[model samples]
Target chain A: MSVELISRDNGIVAVITGEIDHHAAAQIRTEIDFALERQTPSLLIFDMSGVTFMDSSGIGLILGRQRITESYGGAVAVKNPSPCARRIITLAGLSTLIIEGKKENKNEAR
Target chain B: MKHDNYFKITLPALSRNESFARAAVSAFAAQLDPTVDKIGDIKAAVSEAVTNCIVHAYADSPVVGVVEITAKIKDDTLYIKIRDKGCGIDDIKQAMTPLFTSKPEEERAGLGFAVMESCCDKLKVTSTPGKGTTVTLTVRLDKKELA
Candidate 1:
């Protein structure tokens, strides 16, 4: 899986595409973390509308990002998760972090 | 009696192989005519099992170990066995507990077995310390409905 960062409202929206397993988590984590360290946005949004598949590793990815972002007084939100992804996230007890998929202009990051 | 329809594959216990292993099994499971949702469940569980093999089982070892996956159809049940030759769990019960991960520092949510259990009809794990681990996941795909 790959993450494309979109800057909006003083935050970063990471649009993830492809299946996220333990294998793909490494690269995806690094890219997002790098953006966090550089931009240090006030919010981190995981737009999973393109995520066709994700397991526990995906949960871990989000949790880890939350931990990092929290230390910097930042926030995280998951947008438009697939049914399977929503089920696993809810099972992991992170459903509260999800946001409705609505009203976002696609502003590509620099 | 054992079902004659089955397939086995052996691959290096690498993280990248997780996707490959799950896809292979899903393809084989097509014979059961399972719904896309059921197939999604099977794929997620398979990914978790294979990840454990790569992360926990072969975590310390520099040598790339092997993961064996076998899928079989018996009656309406789909049986999947994911075996790994690595440092097996010392306590299977503890390992299966939700939010219990040996590699917590690595951000492992420790929900592998929990996810597997929720997705499958039956979840069984057997491990031998320093030997290996075999995770058996069974899903009932009401093939009768399709028939």
Candidate 2:
């Protein structure tokens, strides 16, 4: 998967696309970490709407990012995860990290 | 009862193939006309097992070994076997334990087997310490749809 960094209000948004497996996780981790380390923002958002597939490797990626952000007193959240990624995320018990993705959709519909 | 299908693939246990292995199995399982959630579950389980081979099975070895994936469908249950001829697990119980990763340095959460077990109906692991490991995942399909 590839990550595109965008500067949101106070947090940085990482729009990730493609499949995330062991190989792709490493790359996505590196890219996100590089950005996180560079900016050291207080908040980071992961946009995974374009991710076609994800397994535990994706879980590891999110967990690692959470660990990193915690170390620096920053927060990380997930947004717009695809159906597959959402299932994996919830199964991994990181449903707390999900935000805006589900809630925002409801708001927009209303 | 006409859902009888079988296929096997052997490829080097490279991290890159994790995607192929899982996707191939998902595509094959799709013949069951399972829900998207079911497809996601199968793919996640397949990936966890395949990742084990790429990251641990062939680890610390001079050569990248091969991981064999054999899939069969019968009675509407999908059975998959991911086999690798590399360093095997000494303690199956310990390896299957959640948050019990052998490679913590690589940011492994040790939740591979946990994810596999959660996603599939049954998980079986057989291994010989010095020989290799074989992980079997079984998923019972839902012939009906609810979405």
Candidate 3:
């Protein structure tokens, strides 16, 4: 998997791509965590549009990040998840954690 | 008792091979002409089973264990069995409970068995401590209805 970090004034957007099974979760987690540590944005937006596949491991990755970011007084948001990815996330009872990105207001952080 | 087609593969219980196992099983199920959603379901279920082996089965040992996967197709049904020779579960009942993970520190949701049970038509798990664990999943293909 590949994670591209976009730094904005409001928060950091992580655009992740490729399959996110157990094989790729560790690397993706490390990359995202490194970016989070460096940026320390108020909000972390995960652009999952490019993600083709995800499983429970992906859930764990998100939860892990949420815990870390929340500990530092930040929030996590998932944007534009695929149908399959959405299913897994919802089944894991994480639907409330996702926030749709605003298309009209690109500068908005939350 | 009979299958028109069958395939078997044995791979080391490594986290890196989880995707490989999922892809192999999905490709094998493709012959049954299942829908994309059905295939996704199968992939999700297989991934959970394999992840369980990699995480829980070999939790203690430095030496990696072996995971065996078998697929069989009969008529419009697909059967998959994932077996692991590692530290087996002491309690199958508690293990199958949703949100019951032994490794909570790893951020495991403990929904592995729940996901597999929801995705497949039938799910069966059998394990013996100091022996091994086998998870059998059966899914009915919707090809006939779609055809």
Candidate 4:
């Protein structure tokens, strides 16, 4: 998985690529947390346009980040999650946390 | 009735292998000519089952544990079984409960079984505390219309 942090005037946008599974959650959490710490942006946007698949572990990663951001008076938002990923996030009761961003038409085949 | 096709694989209960298991099962299910949504559902169910084995089943082991996955197609239904020989669950009911993870520190959402249940037609879990745990998932493939 690859996470690229872009500094915006409002907040930081993290563009994440690849699958978010148990194996990739730790690294993702660490990277995003580091970015959050350094940037300390009021908002953290996760761009999941390149993400192919995600499971419950992805929920844990997001919740963990949410805890960190909330502690510092910052908020988290998810952007452009694939249909499959969106379903998992919704099932975990986290769809409300997602801020609808760019919509992608990619089919989740994997 | 006997299965028309069957596949089995044994892998170490490691976090990295979770994706491999999911991919393997999804590839096998492709024979049913399912849609992308159906394939996604199968992958999601398999991922949850395998993740449970890696996280909960082998929670405290210095050595790597083994997880066995078996997929079979019978008629229009696909059957998947994931077995782990590590630390078995004490209470199957409690374990299957939504948001009932033993390791809260790990940030576990505890929605593994719930996701599996939602994605598949049937989910059956059987375990013995000292023995092992087996999760069987049954998914029905809808007949595709000819173009």
CA RMSD per model (angstroms): 2.1, 3.8, 2.8, 4.4
Candidates sorted on DockQ, descending = 1, 4, 3, 2
lDDT of each: 0.89, 0.86, 0.88, 0.87
lDDT top scorer: 1
lDDT of 1 by residue, B12-124 (tens): 98787888999999999998889989999999999999999999999988899999999988877889999988998998888888999999777789999999999999999
Count of clashes in candidate 3: 0
> What residue pairs clash in candidate 4, if any at all?
none
> Which candidate model has the greater DockQ, 1 or 3?
1
Instruction: Report the lDDT tens digits of candidate 4 across residue range B1-147.
Output: 544999999999989898899999999999899888889999989999999998988888788899999999999899999999878889889988988889878988889999999999999999988688999999999977778
| Collision count of model 4 | 0
Against the native chain B, each candidate's TM-score is: 0.93, 0.96, 0.95, 0.95
Model 2 chain A — which ten-residue stretch has the worst lDDT?
A101-110
For candidate 3, write residues A4-82 as lDDT tens digits.
Answer: 7777876888888888887788888888889888888888888887778888888888888999899889999889887
Task: Report the TM-score of the second chain of model 1 against its true counterpart.
Answer: 0.93
CAPRI category for model 1: high
Query: Candidate 2: deviation at residue B97, Å?
Result: 1.4
Candidate 1 fraction of reference contacts recovered: 0.87
lDDT of 4 at A56: 89
TM-score of chain B of 3: 0.95
Could you estimate the TM-score for every candidate?
A: 0.95, 0.90, 0.93, 0.93
